[model samples]
Target: MFGFSIQKLLFTVAVIAAVWYGFKWVGRMKKVREREARERLRRQAGNGGGGGTGESGESGAGGSVSGVAEEMVECPACGAFVAATGAKSCGKEECPFLG
Candidate 1:
């Protein structure tokens, strides 16, 4: 025979509540992380767009910042891919764009 006791019912309810709240907490944390990432990206873009004294030590005409995607071009002679904005020489005689 199956017995349905008040303690069993209460324990089941507590477990359900704990799981529900745990999922909610996890969701909240994920949202917070995503918001922080977006804010960080926004700040980087704002600071990177303004031409400064190059304190970050990033070498480029535009002072390119990390995490930003750049257009790539394939080298005709070496068959290597390089950034289109500041393509460097592949050290080959036929390579275009001076090193």
Candidate 2:
């Protein structure tokens, strides 16, 4: 027979653990949200008006680099973005990225 005392002890431990984890999780999430909000507010204030910064600044602007991003290909069967070199032609089915 399962004793009530043992069951009660386990239940108490479970409840305490649940409450502790919930609090920690919520606190972490709150910090993340606050940080994001502050960054957004700062960016908005700096740019003036409520609108976000117009066009993000690229790190290597106008710097000529032979990168893979420059090479792009459009599937003939489906208008999905794919790499130019080794992309298989979608003959029958539409590409997942497009859908």
Candidate 3:
């Protein structure tokens, strides 16, 4: 014969709560990942569709197209990577990118 006790009831409630919270956490994480993936795809699409040219048949340098991944170079002075296109001085005397 099974007899229900207060301890058993409390334990069951705790287990249910744990499972509910776990499910909610998983769902929230899944939604966050999905949203991030969508954002990445949107950025990629907006970035000239991976082509260096835009609808006007001009290169990305013309400013007509954007989202192109630029080459990054390490700053000799700061050792931090920066966009190579318009690299600027890091205010260090030895910075090679200094203009």
Each prediction's TM-score against the native? 0.50, 0.46, 0.45
Write the residue-wise lDDT of candidate 3 on 1-99 in tens digits. 145687788899999999999999999999999999997886776665456654432244655443456888999789989999998889888899866
Highest-scoring model, TM-score: 1
Model 3 lDDT, full chain set: 0.79
Candidate 2's displacement at residue 47, Å, is 0.8
Off by over 4 Å in 1: 1-4, 51-72, 78-80, 90-94
Candidate 1: tens digits of C-alpha lDDT, residues 1-99: 135687788889999999999999999999999999997886676575566554443235675555557888999999999999889998999999797
Model 2 alpha-carbon miss at residue 77, Å:
77
lDDT of each: 0.81, 0.70, 0.79
Ranking by TM-score: 1, 2, 3
Q: Rank the candidates by lDDT, best first.
A: 1, 3, 2
Residue 36 lDDT, candidate 1, scale 0-100: 95
In candidate 2, position 14 carries an lDDT of 100
Candidate closest to the true structure, highest lDDT: 1
Per-model C-alpha RMSD = 8.2, 13.3, 8.4
After TM-score superposition, what is the CA distance of residue 52 in candidate 1 from its true location, in Å?
Answer: 14
Of the pair 1 and 3, which is ahead by lDDT? 1
**Candidate 2, overall lDDT?**
0.70
